[model samples]
Target chain A: MHLTFYTIWPCALFNINRMQSISSSSYAVHFNQRAYDALNGHLSEKSYSKIFIVVDENTHEHCLAPFMGRIQGTYDFEIIELESGEENKNIDTCTQVWNVLSELDGDRKSLMINLGGGVITDLGGFVASTFKRGIDFINVPTTLLSMVDASVGGKTGVDLGPLKNQIGVINQPEMVLIVTDFLKTLEERQLQSGFAEMLKHGLIQNAGYWEELKEVSHFKLMDDLIYESVQIKNKVVLEDPTEQDLRKILNYGHTLGHAIESYFLENVEKKALLHGEAIAVGMVLEGYLSKDLVGLPEAQLADIKNTFLGRYPKVDFTEDDIKAILALLKFDKKNSHGNINFVLLKSIGDPVIDIQVPDELYKKAFAYYAEN
Target chain B: MHLTFYTIWPCALFNINRMQSISSSSYAVHFNQRAYDALNGHLSEKSYSKIFIVVDENTHEHCLAPFMGRIQGTYDFEIIELESGEENKNIDTCTQVWNVLSELDGDRKSLMINLGGGVITDLGGFVASTFKRGIDFINVPTTLLSMVDASVGGKTGVDLGPLKNQIGVINQPEMVLIVTDFLKTLEERQLQSGFAEMLKHGLIQNAGYWEELKEVSHFKLMDDLIYESVQIKNKVVLEDPTEQDLRKILNYGHTLGHAIESYFLENVEKKALLHGEAIAVGMVLEGYLSKDLVGLPEAQLADIKNTFLGRYPKVDFTEDDIKAILALLKFDKKNSHGNINFVLLKSIGDPVIDIQVPDELYKKAFAYYAEN
Candidate 1:
């Protein structure tokens, strides 16, 4: 594999306060009280045919009333709830929601607000984009995974069979509302799933962010971290809207990350790891490869290993599991012309893309992850 | 509704040769020999992981062998075929194709060639667009309806139940290959269905073209007409990619035309008319409303009525059928905030969009359609 250097996106594109909203190409990501205000103003400004809020059972019970209470206008909104799980995030669910929207008289001018986690935002964003050849939608992300990741990058899709996010589109929402209160609704496991992505934001684009993120004792204490993670993500997305080059860096750990997540999800006996948990394992395996290929320092490599292992315990990978996981790597979206490409970090805050790692090194990388 | 004048897309954007290709936002429409040459050049140029050619049953039997014989490359291509007709143009069919793509190792770098009528191009385009957040695709339209209308415009979508094209996105294919020879495979009724769009194009934009179109006794002899019709369609689509304002004029007869089409499609007892056959009736119905609503002259209205009636025999619509057709208009993608909008003509070749005709006039319009 040959080394190709890429320009890292600037951390501070401009000086702004901690709570300020970040804007991408077509939409803005508003935070907290400002998010609700922006939504209300937008609602009042445009004459929508209808307003539909998409939620999972958890969000419908928890996030919906609070989200609706914040609305300042006298608008009627229909709540379409789906069953919450990664399994439910597929084309079949999208069909059900689409049928509901059509049955409820949802038209071209209808506004859809996605009020759950990544599944809600990704699935709901896709539903709005395709229904009637596109409709306006807002993402009121209610989980850390969605806010830090799916909130900025217009990556709306669902899993096709065992593959992760195999069907979807990159169409932006009208706006993204990041409410930290919704983050509190998540359990430690789900919250940590999002936290893993924030830590990735630091490792790929900002060393200071990685340093600050690694120091956080509690996952709940993340208002500032969410802002910083989104800034890093938004900066990367703005530079590459359609994910040509610079955007692949955002998929740094996601190369093996998605494959690992898919393997765990598909295996009948294995307990399904949360999105971040699977990615957490991916970072370690890829980090081991980065040390040899990208000259990642020994001390920093150790730091990376310890930082994640502290929260994410190592899972038992049998020989069959490892073989299956390796087989799934070829199905990754990043792959082209039958070669597995890696987005490796030259160092913290420095990323190199489209680097091929040979098939021979797979076992060694897994050995490094399994080592004391 | 007040009269608003829109700048009609010019016939002579630039004086290119008769058989020359026409360019849209990102892709071009290549004719006959030029179409085959472009496809061969495209196939040899890109290193695609897999080449998927989407076809319907009819195209698989007739269009595929001839289409494949033109290709100069030795590249392996996979054929994914679906059931023909508008009934198959829905999310369920899209799910089947998407599954087929995943099952076979179709990836981001794969190239899709749509080789069928409008349903194939529309559904295949959506499948390619959403498969792994979109892959590159080309269109080789195999019907007169598809060649003249769906060739230039990047309107890729599937029908939602009874509503026509109520689901999908405005995504462009890599290139479109328009081969007039394939029109021979279409039945007389199907050819007339496409001819309806050609008539509408001339009515909405060019009276000189309309006069020429009326002179052609056979739909079989339409090479220059197809080129000119695509030129008109391409000019309008280029000006407005997302159908915001100027593009609305293209929907001249489609407002009531789609409603009539859907009404006939949903009722199993009623014979399902080809798209253009229903639109021919719509032009008569809407032309009557245009006389009173948009100052359409008596002579021009008679010209339109006689031109369409000469081709399409009148169908007896029970009073109930007329009521059901009118009720179906509310579900149209063009409607906004519960207002039924129409694209009415001030005269031949000049149309005004977003005009509302009162309920009192719909019955009168139907009566005018029933006139001797």
Candidate 2:
């Protein structure tokens, strides 16, 4: 199903024609302008029983019409609008979608398009995976974070209460269409949240991409680089579809990031951290953990902190808060047994997964904030 | 995996020295006397992590120890007892088993041995199947009906509210051990309930078996014929696993039986019809439906009706009540679209599936019951 997506780019911007590819098995991560075009073209060719585009209430009001218009298909499509927010990402909402699908007499042949941010994609992907055992779905991520992060991997689930992704299965989507144009409609906070993951992609895999991104402060200039980030994620995910080994590296900032996200979610008055924003902080803190655990070069650790601190200077947490966050990390779903395994950078461009840090190192990592 | 189970029976009564082909999926369905020998064999050869014997409350108190003592093994197996009755067959109870399994760190290499009647086998099979996607379970059916019906087919599920087997998936057991010795512990009603299914199995598939069962009034007389009934059920199940086509023959009495079961479960003060009892009555009423739908011979219908009528007599249901019962059949999970489908007999031994009878015929089937 080939599709043509139009992007509103500046006249003088060097448009590299952003393309992304996602793989579940050990398939090479293919990324270029042609790959994205090919994927879109492939989807447009199939005649489905129904075109069901699931979105959150926010995205339904914001992004659905243009998405329907952009697709070349002449088929009629239906929208299942879900409530927007992390709190609503759960099995209850999945029941609602199941009801809608059942009421509509959706058969094995129907297509479910998740067109929104992470919640829509995550929940929609989960619903499709479990509906009648399983079915096909495509992800059209609108948020910058979802475009670069959620779109590539098939990690789809709703939170089980405060326990994130406790009840879920591993199922990959058939295709993921990441259009950076959707980023234009995002809130600045959401934009920054997504950009953090993109920076992590550069930090963990490609030094050249990191150097290039450092030179450009124009947020729009990062749009073309989303494909590069997706490529790195796809490579990691494809190698370990079931998260047995290599995929743990992608959890770089997520260990502490999830704890922070869960903490703020419970303390409703506190500022909510978008996943990417929390993870950006997590990446910095985890970078310090890497320095302590793996003897990462001190100079490289300073560079990682300075780059994130320069962009996100307002993030402030006391050592006590870090202690609390560290406690939350212990309950991370990824952790097996009692070990608090951290995925840390071997260097600026390499991530080594399953690195265990001692309790004292966690204190030292938090102490770095005081020294700074 | 090899598991040895024993029943108190003379060695001369059991047979099966001729069939000795061993494959990876080797499961021995020990019937009656042969079940006694199974208990006397070495269990480690059965390849099981932990031997978990599932039984209901009633079975636990009355027969658990005797059954356990008969099944000699090097290691004393843990008895995971459950509350008796169809009411306890649900996700909550399954959750109890899951919690136990999780606490025990039961892996994919574990085995679950279901010991009781239909409830233990069905619910236990479902718990094992879904615990870690799937697991192996052995069904040791103590009741006559489950021996021939439930144990043969891999249909495992708990009821959804008043609905029978509503939330379930199809998964076959690794082996079925039919130990009729346990039948001595059953109440008269439970024994009769189980006999009803065995009669229906004979009526639908084996006319000779049906004739043979006619001479057997007590569990002791039918003990000799238990193997014959189970083999018929196993053959039919092997031919059609999912009940998509010919598997419906097994549902010969189920159409009206299910409606009757559901009706009593909701309105009547007395206990609901046991599955076999309900299906037994269903066979007689559906014999009338089959007369028109499949041109079932009058002599054959009369034979079916006379056999069941002689055994069960008639349960009271007003003309209005029969109409209501027929209406409830419309919501049977087996029905596709809006039609009420049935497995009607073409003759005493030939069964047809997916047969849709007209509303007038449905009314006639029940009206015939009232008139007779």
DockQ measured for candidate 2: 0.12
- Cα lDDT tens digits, model 1, A1-372, are 111122222211112235987889998999887787788789889988778888888998888767776776566577787888999899889888888887777888899989999999999999999998899999988988988999998999999888889989999999999888887777988888888999899889999989988888887657888888899899999999988899999887888888888999988899998889988888888888899899988888888889889988687788898899999998897878778889998898898999899888888888888888
Residue B301 in model 2: shift from native, Å?
3.2
| B-chain TM-scores per prediction | 0.94, 0.87
Clashing pairs in 1: none
**Could you give candidate 2's per-residue lDDT for residues A119-236 as a string of tens digits?**
8888888778656445678777888888888877667776655556644445667677665656778777788778888888887788898887777676675645776787788787
**lDDT tens digits by residue: candidate 1, B23-82:** 889989998888877777887788777788888779988987777767764665788878
Q: Give the lDDT of residue A131 in candidate 2.
A: 61
lDDT of prediction 1:
0.85
Q: How high is the TM-score of chain A in model 1?
A: 0.94
Name the regions of candidate 1 deviating beyond 4 angstroms: A1-18, B1-18
